[model samples]
Target: MAALFLTLLLLSSAAQSAERTLVFAAASMKDAVEAMARAYRERTGNPVVVSVASSGALARQIEAGAPADLFIAANPDWMDYLEDRKLIDVESRTNIAGNTLVVVTGDGAIAPPVDPEPLLRSGRFAMGDPAHVPAGVYTAQALDQLGLWEDLRPMAAFGENVRVAMALAARGDVAFAIVYGSDAELSEDVAVAYIFPPETHAPIVYPAALTANAHEDARDFYAFLRAQAADGALGPYGFTKPAAGSGS
Candidate 1:
């Protein structure tokens, strides 16, 4: 009986060790990543833990000694940041998905060639803070290209992340918001006021990679996400799958 109990304890310990993996991803990746985690869990009987926030914040957290095994960044820049710090496994990095930037209105009708002066005079607009959030970075790029950044600068309400900016727009607390196209799909309360031209700013690409300290299981999960991108499983969540033969 004593021998059997010891064996059982060892088995439990191995199982626990096999189950440990931590994934840090962008806020925009919330629903889709959760669904992918569920599918992986069902298939492998191993659970994936996810922490969702701004890509920059997650990168900083990882740099600060956070135990993240995998990271999915909203853009290449944050991944580049981690790479520059030598925190990521260079060969494991891959382009997982893409997104579009748009302006959404919580209430009232607003359209293309958005006249920022009138809207700013009436109500505040929401944007993720350009300092560390990719959505805001894209928004700033687009607005500046459109020649509206200077006029609309002071009327913007900055949020910690893109989802929060979308929420503010959804609640009608902000007249409009700049967020991912996928975000507009999440909230019925808001509508796309305008789809910014892709050329207006740098392409919004989601790049993913494993941390240098990642466990073996993390490699499997990282591969799973890339396969999902290939399988088009992430399409419903508003992610653009890697094109065929693009070698994602």
Candidate 2:
């Protein structure tokens, strides 16, 4: 009888110890979030399961009951979508990081252009699909500000996400791509051709929050992500700290 009791206790303990948090994050945040998840696991002995995709897709998945505990979006619109639907804990929403757009090209395949229009007009350039991808939306905003969106629309090759768009540039399928600055730093096959000025579009922000039905471990992990440890991990991956007063 004692042996049976001991076995059951051990099984229960193991089950409790195995609890993990599920995080849905934007594709662009893959590196930084994975690094932070590793650090969190080491520090707390709790595992974090990460799912990466475009913010729009992730949001729809969450809405369809994907069972994500936490969500990190590359832009506020997706977070707002959930918040408006009461799918996320509004009080927990906070902007955690910032990013900027850059033009990238296959290494040694194209020269950086001083005037972006000529290169964009000369050959197809890759961009995220502005209909849903935040990176593409930002790229569209910047191009519009430069008065190039309409004229260059016909030459644009749209990708489902920033990584897809960047890959097209890296593969030399397109002359250049507009993607997050952090993405350009990650690949040896690609090089930054130009950086859009900050004023060219709205500031890029990464907002993180717990889902409305998040478990205790999710809340703990969410707190850890808002602390200094996460901030340290993000910087190495080209993510900038959010400016003071940045909102979700």
- The CA lDDT of each predicted structure is 0.87, 0.88
Q: Residue 112 of candidate 1: its Cα lDDT?
A: 60
What local lDDT score does residue 23 receive in model 2, on the 0 to 100 scale? Answer: 98
| Candidate 2 lDDT (Cα, 0 to 1) | 0.88
RMSD to native, candidate 1: 2.6
lDDT of 2 at 222: 84
Off by over 4 Å in 1: 108-122, 242-248
What lDDT score goes with residue 37 in model 1?
91
Per-residue lDDT for 1-248 in model 2, tens only?
Answer: 99999999999988787688999999999988888899889998899999999999999999999999999998889999999999999999888899989998885635667787776676889998888789989999999999999988898998988999999988989988999988887878898878888888888999999999998888988898889534476777888877566664
Query: What lDDT score goes with residue 3 in model 1?
Result: 100
User: Candidate 2, which segments miss by more than 4 Å at Cα?
Assistant: 109-113, 229-231
Residue 187, candidate 2: how far off, in angstroms?
1.3
The TM-score of candidate 1 is 0.91
Question: Candidate 1 on 15-36: residue-level lDDT in tens?
Answer: 9667677999999999999889
Clash pairs of candidate 1? none
The Cα RMSD of model 2 versus the native structure comes to: 1.8
